[model samples]
Target: MAYGQGLADRVRTLAPDRVTTATDLFGTETAETALALGVPPERISTIAAGPNPPGGVRGTGGEQARPADLERITDAILAGEITVPIAATFPIEQIREAVTLQAGRHVHGKIVVTL
Candidate 1:
């Protein structure tokens, strides 16, 4: 999963079997990058926004997370089927540090800012 081109490039270098991008700016460039990385066209999925949308792309206003979905995910995490890495944690007073780390775009996991 990649949020932007920079991360996408990094992911591509790893030659993943599939690439999923949650970027509103997904376009030809992103697709090309994936292709160059040897990811099959059908294996690349992207999320885009707008009324017209891109050709051959279906638009879903986006899915809302139901309580059951959240519960299932939580259960998976608790069962060790899913793992969420925490890159760093900061107290609320150090929110700036957390934000800075997040903005650096090099984080491989979630950054938690605690209350």
Candidate 2:
């Protein structure tokens, strides 16, 4: 709750009721931290495993995670119920425009610039 001199960085989880926002995995070298935070590996059982690489959840924004939240999203994505739409693709020269569009919330999903 307080950001002082020596506090470890923390993130806000989508489900604060049952999620952790730290970058450490429950079973990795960060085990002690996870234990201190009360997030165990067993709580990560049903995650709708992805072909994507691990540590993919780390974000530019500090967002927290609960396994259930991940499963819910993965299920919807896999089921074609919810999709990440590529709203627009532009050329390299158009990168600035694309960013402006995104900043203004005019673009949805991912905005990409190609060669």
Candidate 3:
């Protein structure tokens, strides 16, 4: 799934043989764009039944309707099957530093704050 207008086209171009399905998680607005890029209507899908709100997939409702990619990651997190690297850890009092650290270029993973 892609949020941008031309992104699906670019992805299709990257792997024309591999990608058979596409989802416009943002809803019908991009469906035409996907179609224009040669994806069939039957291969396109929306996570929810209606128009999606402003924030795209994140704005869509709960886990039940979320795309498979999100579900996989969530399951992995819950199962402790993956680890999110911690770039730095700070106490709650250092929230500012935490934000600054997150904004920095060298921080590759999450900056965690502890209570």
Candidate 4:
């Protein structure tokens, strides 16, 4: 879940030895930094979308998905195989507050705003 080089460097500096794997959903620069920090190529994985691709390495995290993949996921949701959590609900009038709450990032799941 690291988004910046600083965070990645911090992870490298403070990561526990027991942690054998890390996922970089940020970009390739962070992934390279992870490698420089002594994490093996296989242990440090990244997603294929976002600012950069995985630099030819297959992304271990499921951040990159095609339209078909999204469709399949939607189908699964419709089929009751997947569930979406709603952290909070608000009326359209409270949209501003809802946005503020989401920016706080303390909620456990999606925030729904009723129209």
Candidate 4 local lDDT, 17-48, one digit each (tens) = 53454555444766666565666777766764
Q: How far is each candidate from the true structure, as Cα RMSD in Å? A: 5.6, 11.3, 7.9, 7.2
- The digit string of per-residue lDDT tens for model 3 on 1-115 reads 3345576667677778755545444345555555566666676666543754222322234554557877897898889976577779999999999988777745656788999
Highest TM-score, which number?
1
What Cα-based lDDT does every candidate model obtain? 0.61, 0.50, 0.62, 0.66
Least lDDT summed over 10 consecutive residues: which range in candidate 3? 52-61
Model 2 C-alpha lDDT per residue in residues 11-105, reported as the tens digit of each score = 22423464543333222333333334566544322222233213333222214566688788889889997656787898999989888888885
Location of the lowest summed lDDT over 10 successive residues in candidate 4: 48-57
Model 2, which residues run further than 4 Å from truth?
A: 1-82
Give the Cα error of residue 10 in candidate 1, in Å: 10
Of 2 and 3, the candidate ahead on lDDT is 3
TM-score for candidate 2: 0.30
- Between 1 and 2, whose TM-score is larger? 1
Off by over 4 Å in 3: 1-75
User: Candidate 2: which pairs clash?
Assistant: 12-64, 13-64
Minimum summed lDDT over a 10-residue window in model 2 is located at: 53-62
